[model samples]
Target: MPNIEQFTPTEAYEALREDETAALVDVRSRAEWTFVGLPDLAELGRDTILAEWRQFPGMTPNPSFLDDMTRQMGGTTPQTVLFICRSGARSQDAAIAVSQLMEEAGTPIRCINVAEGFEGDLDGSGKRGGLNGWKAANLPWKQS
Candidate 1:
């Protein structure tokens, strides 16, 4: 069993750059993607940008998150799938869930949680995403 890893947005980006099969999975709410934006992986033309959540603006864990993710990947190959969420919490949970699901299915997928998510740290006043994540790494993202 391969160990699951936690990746910085920068490291995740580098993985995408080097591996054609590598994929970034944004597990955040639809609102997060719309409002805060996402990493621009124009290089991976066929790589998927998908949401495991069916709703918007909330942080509740989707019961079907693993199933949705399995559907998104389309198979049980041990592909490098990086999970990202609002902060790092949800993504970490998502990663663990996916890993466990894959293990049970005998697919043995490689999952990484993107530490700090899209909008990472809070500002001095307890704001979010001002310190870490894809935006903090200075990655390319489109604002909504």
Candidate 2:
């Protein structure tokens, strides 16, 4: 089995609501977050952590990703962390990396890839956010 698990946006939202130790991490670039909007976790009394798995423009991997995650998580280490991006791919990579890191730290966590992500897959018109994502599912979200 892979180090990470996969869940649809609705499933992830439910898990986050049910599990107090569950948290979310958005791995899209800052530009994407600003332009495409962000997941709203305020209802859960939490805020989604923002960290780039890959930087904008060049799309280069962010060297400080793990560090940023650790810092953003602070003293409270969540038992479950859901990772989301524009689509599922990048979030999966982020989930795997974090899973490995947490296991190595002797604090194994359930790292989940929000499979459909915030924007989901492309539509017939070659666009996203309308098929099967967090936004499409009508989950809480907002623009920056």
Candidate 3:
């Protein structure tokens, strides 16, 4: 329903590097962020917005997601907002939701999804990290 585009992890990273006003939102749970890992944007002098799309334990949608986004952005103007999740589905939904909201609000922010996601799809060995994701794409990341 909104103008949400899909981008590979590398493309998204490049866009973020090129666009000073772009945002990289990680819509993963706190547990995943702590145990799995997170994108390290420190080299670019930027930080990923760690906003949970869903709450942990029960995996419920976060009611204050937009609020958290707004707070993380410090009430800045809407710009290129990128969302990423475990295997991409959740972040895609999150991007669509945010895109629609921004459109309704007349801001029309560019919402993009890291389609391969952070951890990526499961491999033939039933693993994730080794698959096509942010980490697998060889993007900068750090363990928390």
Backbone clashes under 3 angstroms, per model:
3, 0, 0
Q: Rate the local accuracy (lDDT) of all candidates.
A: 0.74, 0.91, 0.91
Residues 4-107 of candidate 2: C-alpha lDDT, one tens digit per residue = 88899999999999997788999999999999999999999989999899999999999999888768889566888899998899999989888887788898
lDDT for 102 (candidate 3): 82
lDDT of 2: 0.91
How many backbone collisions does model 3 have?
A: 0
Q: What overall lDDT, based on C-alpha atoms, would model 3 receive against the true structure?
A: 0.91
All candidates: TM-score: 0.84, 0.95, 0.97
| Model 2 lDDT at residue 30 | 96
Rank ordering of all candidates by lDDT, starting from the highest: 3, 2, 1
> Compared with the true structure, what per-residue lDDT tens digits does model 1 show for residues 36-115?
78777775564545665535545555777666666766744437888887777777877787788778877777889888
TM-score, candidate number 1: 0.84
Which structure among the candidates has the greatest lDDT? 3
Off by over 4 Å in 1: 1-3, 53-58, 74-78
- Residue 24 error for model 1, in Å? 0.8
Candidate 2: segments with Cα more than 4 A from true spot: none
Error of 2 at 48 (Å): 0.3
